[model samples]
Target: MVVAVVAAGGPGPLINGFGVDTSCLGYDAHNVAQGDADNTSHNILHTHSNKSRQSSPGKNFPLQNNSIALEIMVNVPKERKTYCAGKCKKHAVHKVTQYKAGKASNFAQGKRRYDSKQMGFGGQTKPVFHKKAKTTRKIVLRLECKKCKTKKQLCLKRTKHFELGQKAAASGHQY
Candidate 1:
């Protein structure tokens, strides 16, 4: 169930109905050259009401206005073939997993001070951030060498959807 969508302008990688060839979604090069923000600069989304025979709207590709749908195939297996520094060789099979943040410590100095300040405060003391711009986070992959067990971290480009392992067949292979 792959959906095919294309933008009107801009130089981007070509993608066929079966697969995506590049990681980039199309964008206006003129706007990008002026240093404008990415998502807020465009609004080219439209739904074709006459195309009722098509499968669910973007069942294969999710669509958003002014934004291009990037059909990146990022589903990686739990193991990978790459160079391992510990073994000092290439073609080493490394175990792959998502990196998770460690638990926050209650005894940290900042936490203690914030806790005391909020105990009898008339209003909130610290500022909370709300003006977030980016829609997706850069995924981090944790790799461990099977032989030496040396661990390493790799960061991927930012994207809206990310999957760790091979998707099940029943899910329609939407990644």
Candidate 2:
């Protein structure tokens, strides 16, 4: 068994494949020695050790489970011009609006079925999913052609917040 010991800012004792005491200068020395031993282990160990040195704190380091506040503000116009597949096959002026989900129906087929199953006292009937992965939903834009009044839906990239139009700019001179 090859036991590799890694420590910060100190000369550490390492136990190699053979059961013997080996003194390593530091991580840099180990990287250099491993690089000379084999090409594969050299590449793997050498590149892996240099990443933390390459990266610093507060420099766009991506966190897997943590939520980051991007604080991004978006500005979109209320109207847009694009090709309409309806009556206007050519480019036409279109009105842009944010799309929203409708309210859940109490009499929907799935809802009715689930309600019927849970009518009697049986604790819980269906499995309630709790493992939510995403924190944001993709924003959908509703585009309506001004000429033909034809509407189409456009999906935007996911974001925490969505804005319809640009906010009013502040005047330079105050009254």
Candidate 3:
């Protein structure tokens, strides 16, 4: 009697012999390397390696488990446009010149109209004073792109309106 073992989707029988029982062969047990066995499955053939597989040309590969995808924004230059304080325009306003009204006060007058107790002059006559004239300043606006050496004027305001280091005129150009 001839016995044959046929494999599923296989071209030929796995084993065939005359005068033999196919049931005696049983199932072929797979051997795996150390740490190759799957913890959830007892079957040796179901074990998988921990190493990641690299992609080869002309091969369809599935995404790996625990992979993260990211979206990035790219800046492209077309017709250069400018964004102003609250409006967008075809040509950006190079400079916004702000003319502030001059402040007039007598605080700067050096005239000593009154003497304090700390001055030690209880009844001395007040000394004559001279006031320094206030001066005006001109600020230039500038904007530049770090990647490209392109620059343009932005906006300008009186120096008095800004604090030290807080002045937009003296602030470095932002890309």
lDDT of 1 by residue, 1-175 (tens): 3223333254432333222222245544333333346542452232233345657655655554214423454677899988887765666889999999999999999999999999984888889999998877778999999888888999877667778887845655555
Off-target runs (Cα >4 Å) in candidate 2 are 1-70, 168-175
Model 2: residue 57 alpha-carbon error in angstroms: 18
On TM-score, the candidate that comes out on top is 2
lDDT winner, 2 or 3: 2
| Candidates sorted on TM-score, descending | 2, 1, 3
List the candidate 3 regions with Cα displacement exceeding 4 Å: 1-134, 161-175
Candidate 2: C-alpha lDDT: 0.65
- Compute the lDDT for candidate 1: 0.63
- What overall lDDT goes with each candidate model? 0.63, 0.65, 0.35
Q: Which digits, one per residue and each the tens of the lDDT, describe model 3 over residues 1-175?
A: 2222322222323322222222333322221112234521332222233356776743454432212111111222222345533333234533322234567544544423333322664565554567856443434444443334355553433233332223234467778
Best by lDDT: 2
How does each model score on TM-score?
Answer: 0.52, 0.56, 0.17
